[model samples]
Target chain A: MERELKLMKGNEAIAEAAIRAGADSYFGYPITPQSEIMEYLMAQKPHERTGMVVLQAESETASINMVYGAAACGKKSMTSSSSPGVSLMQEGLSYIAGAELPCLVVNVQRGGPGLGTIQPSQADYFQTVKGGGHGDYKLITLAPSSVQEMADFVKIAFDLAFKYRNPAMILSDGAIGQMMEKVYLDPQVPRMKEEELPSWGTQGKKKGQDHKIITSLELESEKQEKVNLRIQAKYRQLEEEEVRFEAISCDDAEYIFVAYGTSARICQKAVDMARERGYKVGLFRPITLYPYPFKQLNKLADQVKGMLSVEMSAGQMVEDVRLAVNGKVKVEHFGRLGGIIHSPDEVFNALLNKIIGG
Target chain B: MDIKDIIKEENLVYKRTNVLTENIMHYCPGCGHGTVHRIIAEVIEEMGIQEETIGVAPVGCAVLAYNYFNVDMQQAAHGRAPAVATGIKRVFPEKFVFSYQGDGDLAAIGTAETIHACNRGENITMIFINNGIYGMTGGQMAPTTLEGMKSSTSPYGRDVEMMGYPLKMTELIANLPGTYYVTRQSVHTPGNVRKTKKAIRMAFENQKLKKGVSFVEVVSNCNSGWKMNPVQANKWMVDNMFPFYPLGDIKVPQDK
Candidate 1:
């Protein structure tokens, strides 16, 4: 079947894509930059269309817990929120990961330390890649650079989530979330057949071999450590097979700009501008922020003379860039904070000052 | 004459419920959790809905409640069982879904989930155990702790000014328009256990009616947390706890 093309906001694309992807349930709370997701879902009413449940939860905590419940039932479930709301979801996120349930969480991130700004920021890079909650676990994070990618990643995120039996996050921002772009919506994929889902899901015992329990608490330290190690093994496999990134013209380049999401978009323009100045610059945009493009970036470091990590925060992601670069090339950071986004020209200027200029 | 002929299988009047798991319960000797688990298991067996029931376990003394019931069960984050049950019931509406939570898990930390789930009138049963103190955390003061009652966190007794007052959560939730049935019962005595079992049955039945939320609260005793023998704790619960948390139906469906 031919899928229709639609001009949609990134957040709306997420909602529409979720329905097209046969998501069983969506739980969300309204927040700036991401409010369109719940609004679009409520207005679209997937319940009538595909028998999916759409709910406006009282809070992010309840919303995420609802996702946990639905996912534990082996249903495709998800929630969308902004920075502050995502902060509240950390507790449930940890439990979902620890319990090894598959779900999707979309964070249309805004600037923040505390209620910082409704404007976009990339400050949550460390929180996303490094376990945001207590104890160690990994979330497969997808960074969408455009509304089309935003729509496209919903299906990808859910596929990866269920395949790995772990939570997947679509880490978007205000700009990409609010921007309208042409997107090719996938034709509706049928929800998993009843028998295809895990029989261990809490759907009553009629079809399963034994009574199922979806709990995270192992109690005993030694046994809990084994659970942790099992999770680590999954992460290791993810690192090996799921590393995704966009390498833009890095061949024979002297300078490279490492970024993602909206920051990556801005870096694209800066890269073209820097190229006009004959600096041999290119952009390295990581698609999966967790199993980051560390290997590629490290190899790029050996090729490029210097690198600049551009972001929307006070250089949070640059730390990872530095760790990957490991002094092979002097990696410096350029960012705008408190809802202030750096213009492409400003980024180009920063690249000049940080990486290009002597 | 064979003795087996005198006591035939059809003549058997007493037996353990088949719905109860073979796993040995870890509840304290006198804890009401074991009593409640038995009642719930017996109800499922009697109603013949074991294949259509799902239970959500809380992060309290009955944290391993999944091991005690032979139903599809899920373990929720601390104080989030009601929310978890809401998810399950919404997804599989035909399944009988219930959340089992304790005072510290429900009244103290999960107060919002408890109230909101009831207020929204989710077609699920919430079994809240009010022991007035935290049992799993070694006797810390719970939101339902009686005034002037001493606890690990309240060494000098609960101060109204300091810790606020004991929360009558059942009374609070009963007022919500979403609730179809709300009741408080205890399981200290054989008679009360029978009554509590009836309450649980009604709650489960109401789910099929699709009327609204059914909230069954059990004002129980934590003998170990209270530093008393089980017998003394039951006596104290009747004399002190009952006066504050009177047992009876707080709300009932008009159709019923």
Candidate 2:
């Protein structure tokens, strides 16, 4: 049986969940709103043994490279930081993704553009789901709305990273990362065994066999194009197989509230208040940002009159909503930036202006 | 047959015909790389580690060292061999891991990785070749080039007043407490070659024993970059570069 927990911050949940999930290495430089992760790992990691290698790198560059090194060896590894530090890690992230190495990176996002503030923000929506670094690539981005979801997503991120042989990012904001809540320490479900992992891991080549090679470089244009095509095909398979989301009372509703991560939490409050006020409103939250649940959105578009995209960025995810709606519903955007989080009242007012007042 | 007789038979066959016999070496004739490769091959043969060893070739001239070395090798991005080797070694710690890097690759762009790896005392062997100039990139001045040494980048010679003096990586890394063994050797002549082979063997043994961070810096000559015949470049390295970067073991823990 499962029990309802009290409350825990998102950052603490990520660190604890990573520990429970058998991460062997945690290499990161501290950044605001996410320092708790490093602190938690430093305090609790040594006791676990489990070959945990926790190092405070001289810089984010060093930290990510260290993670790259550890991850290449098939060790479960992770790192956490805020927006600025995550920006610094983009190059290494790209390399990890290109090399098809499994690792987890948590972004407890604060405001951005350059040391923007330590407040909560969803301004990295585009950067996280789309490619943050150069070249054509995508990260498996998990957007969590609660501390429970944060804990649950940690395991999911690790599983998906190995499933796809790529990096998985937990995109949270300062409000979720810093908020205090209770969480379960142990996962109720079973974890995978080491032998279950892909045989490509460099644990030592088979006896009387050639050594395995792990590299990202393919000098020939045709060979690189083939690799890109294979990656795209895998993404397409994910779109078909792994898209997940939650729909809250969208049947016969006039207006739909679409949000994710912290914005989804605010939209939930707005939906509840709007329902109390006799407005026909509902909410749709995307759990996975890359393999976006567009089919569900497309189905909702046929019924709803308008969809409001509530984000903390100016209008990043609104583009995807527009594509999913496909001219069936009017798509509108409401957002705040530079670490300012929107309240339920703000989103409700935007809904009123777009749907009721119209 | 006895083991010695079997070894002699194999050596005789290898002398007559080997897989590496036909590959046109891009390295200049008499370049130290050829000798270095021969020594590395001999070491692998002696230690019986060729099948188990994984070598990382750096982005400079030895970037193509993979072509000649009959072991499984990976080519790293410019100056990223330490980082790559760190990955390979951490994953397969039992494998005999080593990185072949040049002065430009190790001391210039990859300085941070090399220093931190040594400081962290990673159990790996690093064969650092300090040729005093960037040979693969057309005679560019390297971080280990002697003061007042002219190259493509240092048109008026590397002035101490302008560009800083060449770096002595062995002395610098020796100061790190994590370094277990740090030696500076040369591969210029027969005597030095024997010393270099001994140093290489010691480094491999250190890794085998799980002693941390064995570093061997080979002060070599880039004859093409120096615009000298191979013999002249060897003499120049002995005359000018050795005094600045002395050859000897800078640090070795007494316990080891």
Candidate 3:
């Protein structure tokens, strides 16, 4: 039997999980809500002797590049920031993706567009999933709703990044980042064996084998197209194999709630409130935003009369919901932005007005 | 035998012993990159750090420096070699790491990365090649181009009315408290090449001591860009570029 763990905030859990997952380096600049991550790692990193480097960069740009460099050396590395900082990391992120280097980036998203407030918001949904940077690449995006998941997902993110040889992102909002809950730290997972990884990593050139070069540049059009095709195939595999979600009370309900990250938490509260008032409503939470759990949403669409997509952004994920529903059920969107998180009551009322009656 | 034959025979001996070759550089006949590469390779060999050293090559001419150096190397995206070097050094603090960057790749496009890397006191070495023009891109004006120097982009001789003055990166980086050693040297003459080797060795030594960021700006010639022969290009760099960007050690940490 597993023992119950002590309460911890999601941000603290992520920091702890990264260490437990065998991250060798962390580079980040201070940003609201997520600063605790850098703080926690900085305090603990100096004690470890098996080569752990923690650095506070001059800016988000520098932080991401530091991660880029460390990752190139075949070290497990990470960084964390809120929306504005993630925006600054876009250039480096593109390079990381292009170079096909493995690293984890955590976005404890705040409201945005500019220097948005330091409050919790999921306005970065489109940016996170739809390739925010100037390229045709996708980052493996994970959405964790609970503190336990926050701790668990760091390891998962690292695993996926290494598996795919690409960047992985944990898209949580300020609320999830700051919220406190019980978390049990698992025994540290062992890193993948050298043979299991692509032999191209900078572990040093082998004695007889020729020096391996890891580069994204393909000067020939045919070669570039082949790489693109490979990337697309991997993305298709992720969509088929990695889609994850949670569904609640959908068997007898005619209306459903679709949300992710912090919005899902609020939607859960709304579902509970609606059930209390004798309104049969259900909730569907997508845990993987990129390889979205569209199959689950489509199955729910057959029983529900309509689906309400609530987010902190202005209906970014709603497009996905509509595509999943594909006219089988009525789909509508509600959102708030610039650091404004929607209240449970607001979502509950909106569901009632739009799906239940009005 | 002619000088070429002697150099070739010496190169063959070098290949058997020194791990670097005297192969004619792929750079234009008079480009300064070859000189810079020779000095760097000499310094690394002299320091006996070939096995322990890692180099980062940028997106410009030196992007292929990895092909020449016998030690391990990693290539970075345009203007990002310094950041990559920072990462490598931070994780493997015991390893000797350096970045060889060019005018367009470092001073212009990668200015933010270079400045912040220096300012953050990352324990790494940076060899900045300031040729006053983007040689790899066919004679474009670079951030270090003198105000009156003409290039493909600034065909009007870089008018002060429009284009800005040449940036003195060493002088600028010297002001940052995080930097432990900052120097501007040249590679136009045999004496200057020796001076440059000393500067590079000093920077590498600083990293060995974990003293923090060490920067060396090599005032170099781009004969192809300037449309001058090798000797004239060196002369032009001395007569025109040197007065504006004088060479010396701007800062060396007292602690070191």
Candidate 4:
């Protein structure tokens, strides 16, 4: 099959890539910046083309539970929402994580502590990386900065999710979700056959097999503790092997900028502006936020004078950057809150004032 | 004849369904959940769909129902069993899927899930156990608790002015075009038990026919929650509960 290249919005790319990735079902509710994902799926009629199922649920709570149901059957299920809607899904996500079911969730983030603005923001960094709901669990978080990555990470997130038997999230923002760019969508991968499904799935019992019971409940405290230990071990493994980041011109840099998703894009341009002004500056964009590239940042901390954590929030990801650097060198945070997108020049000025001047 | 001879295969009048596991139920003594679970197991065995049936257990007293039902099961979050069942059935339409929930789960916190799932006409069966109180949470007020019904949350005989009226979820859902069959039954008596079993069998059959939602609400007695003994609870259910949640089919398929 030929690789199909087309100009598409990031949301449309997510929808198209999901169908081509052979997803079995998508359950979601309409939310700004991410509503186009379901819209594209419904308009494409993937049910006729690839036998995929698309449903618009009544609310985010319902959407995530539906994903939980389909995922329990060992199907490739997914859901997408913006900030407030994603908050509504935390309980279901916790249940899915506790049950050790594999699925994909995308959050095209908007600003919020409440019904915040529909515009782009990276305020959900703490919510996504740390345990958002009750209990100790981490989503295999992937941050996509461009529309192409928006299409590409859908397949990648699903693969990582199934490989680890854990939920994976594409932590994008409204900018990437709504922006348009050229993307080469992958060829169709066939959906998994019934025989190919994992043995743990609760898709009814095969002859001579014990009943497959998918649940997160363990009344015994000892058993629950063991479950928690096993999950922690998996997280350790992810941190050791799955930390992904991109470094641009950090080989001989005096200052460094750490960011993710939309912030990373802005910092890239800021890095260019600083280099033009004869200051050695580099941008470190983390792709996997949960298995954060802390070790890599620590190595850079030895070489750079200081680091600035840039994001569209009131300094959330900066805490992780500071932890990674661990006082080896100065680390500061620069952000624009409540749906404000900081320009490249503004980032350069912050880099000079917060990191260099300080 | 000796007892062994009386227990011979040919002389056997009743036996437990193989679809039910040998595991002991965790339900309280005289609780109706066990009987309802048995009827469902029997229906699965009779239909011979045990291999293709999936059950969703809710987060109430019957939360551990997965342990007793000898089939594939998924335990859902509080009040989200219907949404979960929708996911399973949509992905595997040929399989029979059902969600078992309680009064607090279905009629209160999960009302949106229940209403939306039924409204979408997902091809699934919903088994609702309405015992009028939150039995697992220590007999708190439930949306199905009768008027002036005293509960832990409603300490003063359920002041109607403050507590409001009990919900009739079965009749309410029956009005939706998505539901193909709706019925309210009880298991306080042997005859009623048989009728309830028949209703469950019909609900499963409706799933096979791909006829939208088939809702079976069992108005049962919760002796532990009601602060009454098993016998008194049954008598009280007959004298008080039936008048509010009368038994019988609320909807059925019309002959083509």
Specify the poorest-scoring 10-residue window by lDDT in model 4 chain A: A197-206
Off by over 4 Å in 4: B1-6
Clashing pairs in 3: A111-A339
Query: Which candidate number maximizes lDDT?
Result: 4
lDDT of 1 at A183: 93
Of models 1 and 4, which has the larger lDDT?
4
Q: Rank the candidates by lDDT, best first.
A: 4, 1, 3, 2
Between candidates 3 and 4, the one scoring higher on lDDT is: 4
lDDT of each residue in B153-256, candidate 2, tens digit only: 99889997788888888899889887888999988888989888888888888887787789999888999999999899989998998899899988876885
Interface DockQ of candidate 3: 0.47
Candidate 3: TM-score, chain B only: 0.91
Error of 4 at B164 (Å): 1.2
Among all windows of 10 consecutive residues in model 4 chain B, the one with the lowest summed lDDT is B247-256
Candidate 2's residue-wise lDDT over A1-358, tens digit each? 5543646677878877787777777888889989989897788764344546677765676677667766766777788898999997887788787777888999998887898999988888788888988788889888888888888888899888888888999998899899887776664333334565466654444556555555566668999999888878878887898888998877758898999988998999999999999988999999988888889999999888899999998989999999999989789999988888899999999999976675
Q: Per-residue lDDT tens digits of candidate 4, residues B133-189?
A: 999989999999999998999988787788889999999999998999999999989
Q: What is the C-alpha lDDT of each candidate?
A: 0.92, 0.81, 0.84, 0.94
Pairs clashing in candidate 2? A7-A181, A7-A182, A8-A181, A8-A182, A73-B91
Q: B44, model 4: CA deviation in Å? A: 0.4
Q: Best candidate, DockQ-wise?
A: 4
